[model samples]
Target: MKKRALLIIAGLFLLTSFPVTGGSAKVTQPPSQKEEIIYHIFQRSFFDSDGDGHGDLIGIRQKLDYLQQLGVTAILLTPLYESVYYHNYFATDFYKIDPRYGTMQDYLRLIKELHRRGMKFYMDMETQYVASDHIWFRDSYKNPQSRYSDYIIYTDKENTKPLQIVAGISDFKGYDGVTRKLVMVNLDNKEVQAYNYQLFKFWMDPNHDGKFDDGVDGFRLDHMMDNLDNLNRLPHLFTTFWNPLLGKLRNINPKIKIVAEQANWASFGMDYLKDTKIDRVFAFRLAFAIRNFNKAELIKVVDSTLIQTPKGKQQIVFIENHDMPRFSDAVKADPGKLKVGCALNLLIGGIPSIYYGQELGMQGSRQNFGITDANDIPDRQAFEWYKSDTGRGMAYWYKNGPWWQHNNNDVPNDGISLEEEQNNPQSLWNFYRTMIRLRKNNPVLIGGAYKNLINNNDHVFSFLRYEWGKKVLVAVNLSGDKQDVVIAMQSAKQIKNLYGIQPVISENNLAVSLPAYGVAVWAVK
Candidate 1:
């Protein structure tokens, strides 16, 4: 079937580069640079070069080639600091990488390796609460006026309310057994306000001179929204905490990128934080829907989100993360749907994040506390890298990490491994690789203006991406039946390539017989 093509771009070329000249010749060339793409790594799946089960910083360093192969420019690692739990959200010490994951030297080696490959890294650090076992917490509990005294906000015993820890792996008693003194950060208390300011300084200031150092490149702020009740209050917190941190980090390295998880807020919040030195904020709502086969819903969410994000601030796109349901498990374990989602995320504006295991279609869910495992590791488990039936290395990188405990041990779930998928051209891993290529080749789709095409058919989603006189129309058949879409835009004239189906026009209406859950893309003539 002939698909209707929109007048996307006047010049449709794959990749543009200047021709080389003889060694003796001096020729001026345009600056060569590409936009950046950051990939998220779960601590468990990065590498197992030593035949260990756990993924350490050295493991990540070993797989830089794999990450570079996907054209990812940066890496955002979940917390690697000292902690009893797996995810390391409740940090025991921000400065120390848990011995299980590797050592500080390992992290330094990782940073050096990534930097050598022209890639950057961001560490997830929780600035709010420490683990119950944290020395600061222990010291504060023992003596109210101890060294860690100002770290926590102390409230009067009579007025303190019982607080329960629900999110992380372990629960700690809060204010229940306290009789004389109760402490909560009095953000309201101006005298103790420095406590909040000092928390950020702990990351930046090595000498405690209120100056940020060059030790780390960037920080991925966890639970950034917890301190403030509303969006308006973010700016003050940013100026006091984030802006200085960014400035300090930049002082050490100018190209550093700072990002945070607002958790709950409009995309416009990125704009508010931009002045505060935040480079990006993860687009949560948009990416969550893409984890499922909801094209129409994803389109709407992306459109609304981009509208709210401030200019120059990125809409960090992602499908799954440590906090959400594993992407593979959400789409009924369908690889096709996963590919389509990957295409959309890579092609959309702003930076794209590939949550760990998204490449292998890892499946997971939350039963009691919602998607969290028994170890309190957010449902994201250790990477399974066993050899496939073909004898390819499924996970040579995870030789040191422990295998994720499966809900059903009887099932033959170990058959699907990365090395196996790497050899299979039609596997989910290859599909993701292809989508990343499309995004890298087509710059217009990355930052282009999105015009969503709405029609009577709910299963078909069509949209136009126009930028710099270039146009590309993208349409996806989200359902099983063939859809006869009447082209509302008369300018759609010729056809390019359908993602997985042949486009044939019928009855003068660009009738394309799209396969079940198929996608079509037309490059404007």
Candidate 2:
């Protein structure tokens, strides 16, 4: 069945290619801002340089030009630490970079290259858990006399069974059905806290120099929640762990941004921001609302998030990430829907993050709901660089893996490879590139205050972005039918179309006919 699926998918890709257009648009240098456009990259699947079929720091360094061209001011990489799993979320060594990624020197060179190109780097860090092979866990598992015995949360004094917060949980298994024993760290342990702090500091400034040229600009704290294990194991994590750790890091580098992936996606991350003082939090609700095309819910979520979030704190809005299926896949690979998603993702008021290959309209989804190592392999497939399955930069390291064999339907010729899209102005990739350029060029769209516009039509979601005498009106048609809607924006001296058809403005009312999945953005004076 899987082989048949792969053949069908390949046949779909082999369809007549869209005629390539000549000439690419040149984008200007974006204005400097505290918040930036970030590109989230799964390093293992991004670009491989050593022909090892795995992406490395050197490969990322070589692609700095590509990132710069994409207008991403920063890049957020998944964990680079040694791990037993392919994702590297569970750390085996706190101090060492995964040999699959590169050595510490290679990391330093990548950081230096990013800095040279005026781009910042942020690494994902999940310090709550460690693989069974991790030295701390290995030493603490059976021996009570071991120095690291108190580092993890064990059910008993003898430390026989690691604390199972939820009974009979088997969600942490790897792709190969191998049960991954990831013991949660006891953050209350002072020694454990100290070790984590040092590990964070080492990555921030590896050389101990006051000049942080070779250091990371920030970290994305993964699975961060006030209560761990859902058993109230670590209830005061924010006060006891995050606050002090963030304080010390800010003392070391005030510009460092620490973003949290709130454990509970349903709730707004305001508590994490206000109490813990983290710089940013993922807007998971907004992301889901957008993905489902719930315009009413999306507007309400955006309004509440913007209105309720405290000052000086930012939200990182994204349609897809490492954990979820690609936006293109979610939207069934419709180019129109992809374009609509791109407009909302880039133009909406927040720090937008583009998942790698999102611009190319990549399609993939987890194959199984059961805890298996191969589940996420579909979502983490190699980036489609060219319009061919086999290409120069394709990272097909997982070709022989069970996950790849089971779910390898997504190929370069899916009509959305970067090479194919780069030459077509109407491609999703160009739409994203153009929208990003527009966002970077317009300060009002970047950091402006968001106001949900009153519109009678449910499918037409309109909003106003205004800041200090600059205002922009944005409306997106979420449905697949032409809709005529009247917006309540009166004071419009000049109007400029950013996407879709231009609007018709009259006294105190703005009317526009939007095609199915049409988007319109206007700079209103």
Candidate 3:
């Protein structure tokens, strides 16, 4: 591990010639809720090191310059713990780093490097279930004499039949044949709770140092819900597990942020936020509405979500994530629509998170279930770092996997690679970088209150972000044709053009002619 770290640092020195947009300086203060712009990365698909065709922690450390260049203040990484699956959500061991992602030393170096660059790191935690190979499951399943016999929920005394829960109406039970059946943890047991608490604490202070600079800044709790297994088995989960656990974590680090991924995205996670005291939750309703181009629905959902959320709490605004198709693919890879989506995602009230490869407009849809072994591989394809499929840094580690056979490896030459788009002024990558810089420089856009502006045109969605006598107006045209719309705002002035069609403000009513899928943002005082 020490040798690997030395090699990674040497590689980073050779790449230091690349220009970084954001200055290199260690941040004295921790990132605030208002100033966070998170970029999510799937480690396996990001960049490879050791020529192993698998992305690792060292790879992420090497790309800190790229992320800093994009103007993101924080990074949300997928799970890095040991798991049999490629995604690593179902952890076999919570304390160990997956060998494919590199050693524990590599992870520590990555965290230290991120902090050195004034960036925050958040990790995804899926502690609800464990892989069949997990010690808790192995010992408890069909082994009454084992001390961990009560650690997992089982249907029979002999423990041959593990209790399965209804994931959804369509799926009666949840399990992957590769891992047999994932055993859901018995959170009711005191010993089980202790294990999870220790696991969380270890990641937060891996070296037992007083300072947490080498630890994660926050966590994204996956598939979090009030009811366990959707069967009301653990109805008091918030009271029993979450509140206490969060209280302990807060005692350790009060600034730690915990965001929940609601089991059902259709409904607001108000219960979890209020009861569990989670810091944030994903705005899935808005994401779905935006992807479908439901202009009215999008506006309505955004309004309700922002209005209903309690003060001091936050929503994680994103277009796509590891579990879903990329936003570009969702909109059929139309660059115009992708730009509009990015505009809304960044300009909204919540902290925006950009999924990896989103800025380059990478396109790949998840294959339909039952048709492929690993349906999600297409969506998690290697980042298009270069024009060629087998270029350096390409993580085609799953080339022998079934999903790779159906993967979208034929990305077009134009508008795909960072090397290509970084040079093109109007490319999607530039659009994201420019918009992010704008948001970072503007205080109103980052921490302001949201107000839905009245627009006569149904296809045009407009809003205002105002705070402390400062205001910014954002208008997005979701349609494929030009539209003239009047925005209702007082004392509005066009200060700058963030992206898309430039707006023209006249009096209290702002009138702008927007091209197809156009976006305009203005600083109004």
The candidate maximizing lDDT is 2
Q: Rank the candidates by TM-score, best first.
A: 2, 3, 1
lDDT of 3 by residue, 1-525 (tens): 122322222112222111111221111222233578999998898999778999988888888889888888899989999987778876789888999999999999999888888889999998878868889888877897889888888778998877774442211111143424566788889998888888888888898885898899999998886788677767678889988888898899888999999988887777776878789999988888889786667767887777677767888999989889878778888889999888888987788999998888887787755622277877888888886666778888777745656777555565588878888999988889888987877877887777766655677888777665566778888899998886655544345655556665545566788899988887764
Candidate 2: tens digits of C-alpha lDDT, residues 214-303: 999999999887888577889889889989988998999999999999988898898888889698999999988898887657866887
- Residue 16 in model 3: lDDT: 16
Give the RMSD in angstroms, all C-alphas superposed, for model 2: 10.3
Q: lDDT of candidate 1 vs native?
A: 0.58
Give residue 371's error in model 1 in angstroms: 12
The clash number for model 2 is: 4
Model with the higher TM-score, candidate 2 or 3: 2
Q: What is the per-residue lDDT of model 1 for residues 130-153, given as tens digits with 9 covering 90 to 100? A: 655676666766466666655654
> Looking at model 1, which ten-residue stretch has the lowest summed lDDT?
16-25
CA lDDT, every model vs. true structure = 0.58, 0.80, 0.78
Worst 10 residues of 2 by lDDT: 16-25
Of candidates 3 and 1, the better by TM-score = 3
